[model samples]
Target chain A: MKTEEMITRLAEGLRPVRRMPSPPVMLALWTLLAASVIGLAALVFGTREGLDRPMTRFDMMHSLAALLTALLAGLAAFELALPDRDRRWAWLPLPAIGLWLGTMGVGCVGELVRLGAEGIRFHVSWPCLQFIIGLGLPMAGLMLWLTRHAAWIRPGPVAGFGALSAAAFASIGLTLVHPTFGPLMVLAWHGVAVLAVTGLAALFGPRLAWRVPA
Target chain B: MSHAQPLCLMLAPGQVARDARDLRWSTLMAAAQEGDGAAYATLLAECLPFLRAICRARLRDAAEAEDAVQDALLTLHRVRHTYDPARPFRPWVAAIAERRALDRLRRRGRQVARETLLDDAAELGAEGEAEERLAACQLREAVGELPQAQRTALQLTKIEQLSLQEASARSGMSIGALKVATHRALHSLRRRLTGGAP
Candidate 1:
């Protein structure tokens, strides 16, 4: 069919679609759902060593950092999903992400000082990795579904941010249950899981999300 | 005598004119998204020429470019809901059109490759008299494996080179029946020869 004819047909058959909620609103909804899912998972699976210690300042600070990262990254992903939006909007989440990494760095340094050079060991916690990733899966699924309507001009970055958002939130849940290992171990394993999710999402997002009929 | 045209004409003036016109497209799109059918039609109509121009610039073949334009229109229709009113319209539409054209280009590339392979196979098939005889013998064996009625019909019509009426009379079957049997026999033999089935 000719382009003009097809356009006419499309316009004639047009139906009003409900306008999508703004990115922030959608991000808020996703954050609420992600928190609930992660909470439920933590309740069911049990934390690494059990929550015997009362909420400490470090714990609260790290959790807040994680929450901020997730929220900011989710907002970035939402903006990136749209076509023709200013690409600069992607940098909005960077400060939060940097702060989160900085906080992790501080914690690592503190641990190193406490343990002394000879005592420091890079421990790999298999259970911790499994828990963060497990919690991330549902969150990632929800985020993908929420953003499926996006124009997806930048699928790789959008998918990466979406996965990072999910993994960041999942890390918060992991911190609640998992025993504190050295900062390096947390960084290594959690970083690996987050990268894995980001890589997979980038690879598969164009195929699975934002499917335009052939 | 007519005045001689300049050899180098600047495109900036025409581009500026087009850009001015395209500025209203976002307004039309926003209105259309609110269920204004006439506005939607106008928006789509306005997009048609621009889309065609983009496709033509990217594609060498006119027919392929037209096909790409249609595909882009279809995709734009499907994804219209994704358009944000606050954003400019041209980039969104252009992105969709460019992606669709790229997809068409890739599919055409693959199709050209497959056609090349088929041409090579045809060349191989035309090798020599010995190979031709061998192929004919294999085809005959494949046809002989068909049901008795189909085999008889194929033999009388194809191998004996008889007319449809003659084959029907010789096989003691109606013409339509003979035609159906011959078609089935040929289909079965082709499948077998092509290694698709026994």
Candidate 2:
């Protein structure tokens, strides 16, 4: 009859959806989104005619973008399934982002070799490199920033490594392919990350040491 | 003005109440097991008003009362596994509301205060306090539709509060006959009351 009583009735389902989140998860997703958008841009360049000469370079960049989108959205969805306290384990994504970004240097060297041998004397041209930097290093930096919340976190080997593996793979395959992902696919991918990150919170977030027990 | 006024019931009126009356708690429990949100919502809606009143009377303030209700409902779902189907549902619910209210006060580390001594038993008025303002009109209107014996038996048992033996003795009927009359009276009353809408 009263408003509070009404709220309590409605709250049964809403209780589990409280927006508790993890640190590593935030980094992982941020890295993924930043990289995905950049990857999408490179995809635009590859599709456009002006950037036709160094095609493989753009293709590889495109592939990395798709991968980041998949990984970030997946992380988001997966983490969301975890319990409330465990939601913050999302911070684990930060270090994983770092580990992932570190791998990009390796991929870029190979691309740099491919570009140099072609005798193409292009100026340090903007969109191409900026796109690559956006996907590759900036994502890593964003992930690292996300993980800065780690001081309050309890050590969790499984989540930490899982997030790291996700980020590392996101970074390792940075220059791997130039596949085209539709916007819907990108959204679904983003959905999955949001779901994972939030799901992980729903499932395991409650156990995170930083979560004040309800 | 009379038609526009809210029903002043513990539950939502008309279709919602009818829907709830049609509800079978057993069905809800089954649907909830399969993760049905709608069924769960219905179940929660049905019990909430009574649970709210109990909580409000038992606890110190509005916030604490609602919080205790939430905790109790969670516990209800948690322990739904243990609810025995054969027993009446109310006492079990009342026991849970009582326990959760007590638990909430204890958690707050405050002494449980009471405006009235018997918290759960508080009433809008003492029993029969409003009897004069409304009485025989309702009973006669509803009971008029019953068979003569059934109507007489019901009046003796309910309004007169006579025991079955006393009712039978007073009415010059066998005990078995009196029981049958009461059952038929209730069936007739239910049909008349509920059938009017449909």
Instruction: For each candidate, give the interface RMSD after superposing the true interface residues on Cα.
Output: 10.6, 15.6
Candidate 2, residues B54-123: lDDT per residue as tens digits? Answer: 7777676889898677766755554443334343354445556666677677766643344343343346
lDDT of 2 by residue, A25-87 (tens): 554565566557556644654444333455454345434554554364346434432222235
- Give the docking tier of candidate 1: incorrect
**lDDT agreement with native, every candidate:** 0.74, 0.48
- lDDT per residue for candidate 1 within B1-198, as digits (tens), equals 001012112288866765666668888888777878789889888888777777777778999888778767766765677787676677788877776677778888988999887667766766674576688899877776799999888877887676675455344577999989989988888789988966
TM-score of chain B of each: 0.56, 0.41
Off by over 4 Å in 2: A1-44, A47-73, A81-85, A88-95, A104-214, B1-38, B41-198
Candidate 1 residue lDDT tens string, A160-181: 7898899899898888777767
- TM-score of candidate 1 chain A against the true chain A: 0.89
The best candidate in terms of DockQ: 1
Candidate 1 ranges beyond 4 A from true positions: A42-61, A210-214, B1-24, B35-37, B102-198
